[model samples]
Target: MERWVGKVAIVTGASAGIGAAVVEALAKQGLIVAGFARRKERVEELAKKLQGAKGKLYAVKVDVSKEKEVIEGFNWVKKNLGPVHILINNAGIIRNNTLIDGNSQQWEEVLVTNVFGLCVVTREAIKSMKENNVDGHIIHINSRSGHRVPNIPNINVYPASKHAVTALAETLRHEITRNNLKIKITSISPGYTETEIIEAAGLPKNNYKDIPAIKAEDVAEGVLYALGTPPHVQVGEVTLFAVGDKS
Candidate 1:
């Protein structure tokens, strides 16, 4: 397989967790990476970690959920790294609450970050890519909850947001096809993963263990595999569930 020797890629939420892992994976393959996140210090540390890798990594701070910031971040990447050849809309926030307990804040935060952020980033990327006439590839990191019930109560907003990702990815693929653009878009849905997101949710580390929950690296590997395919071949959708997950 041909490696991303001179390709430019952008990963949102690269400050940590799955986004960080995705940055590292692409960097090892020699893709110039623009790591976008709101956390300056952590994103800088991630860039430093990738410094020893084959590819060059640049960190930018932006709140992806905000349209202005998203536009600015992508513009910065274009100015500094050239047009993006690949994009991973990996920035996401998860909030758990039942209908009764879930206030508007919890619902709004998850929806805005997961859904609106993805849209904002992708819109900017498509605009830049079209301007540059670059045939780009997009990978969306969705979740298993988007497909089936996890048998857990509450967490309605998180699942709802992920479901929207799944739907949006599929719809975007067709739009690309209709436009006759040489672009590929795919979505990878992961089951419970061991990441800071889960930790922040107050779940025990690796607690989704009826089947061993996947690691951030596992999802990252999935993205790498999708991107590594031949340009003519597109891996449309991948749903990765835990080993023992009935859903």
Candidate 2:
């Protein structure tokens, strides 16, 4: 059975990397997928490709960091496609700078985009989910940096925000449990994967052999796996490291 058939899903950062992979995977599973990104060109191209292939997909231009845009994006999905049954808070940014050398703007950008953006999207999406009394699933693409910062003292802000995300995910899980909203939430901690973000970070391009980088599709598979489980069954957390990227 198609796990996402008839379900509507929202994937942020869908223009590239794991975000794109997740959108593509969900669409292939028969979900009505909405792809959101700040720059619409790539997402639009992906949507056109999906449409041409007779797949269910929609592309929306949004900067997830903006509250109004986040609200409008999810509302658009609800009104046009359907209530969002799934949300992948996959939009994030990385800043490779040390405490003293780091740009203040970069710090703000990292926190606002990775943390605040997540909150806005989740809040609006949950409003719709709760109003409809639907038990939906939210998957956050967090990083291992959340758990243990790399030895490299640079990239401080990136890890700090990710750590916040890790804590936020756990706190949300607890809150939802106590309130009995029945919504399922989980976070996946992924080590270095071959993506544009890494390349932008000045990492090598897609060389997994040395460090064991996982593919974006690998993360997408995890999302689908989580979505497939029965509501009563929840995978609280999943941590994936490329086989050789050892912890």
Q: What is the C-alpha lDDT of each candidate?
A: 0.84, 0.84
TM-score of each: 0.94, 0.93
lDDT of 2 by residue, 8-88 (tens): 889999999999999998888888888989978998888777874424878998999888898888878888987878899
Number of clashes found in candidate 2:
0
Backbone clashes for every candidate come to: 0, 0
Predicted candidate 1 versus true structure: per-residue lDDT over 153-230, tens digit per residue: 556678878889989998998889899988889999998777888666654443354656778999998998898898
Find the candidate with the highest TM-score and give its number. 1
Off by over 4 Å in 2: 1-3, 52-55, 201-210
Off by over 4 Å in 1: 1-3, 203-211
Number of clashing residue pairs, candidate 1: 0
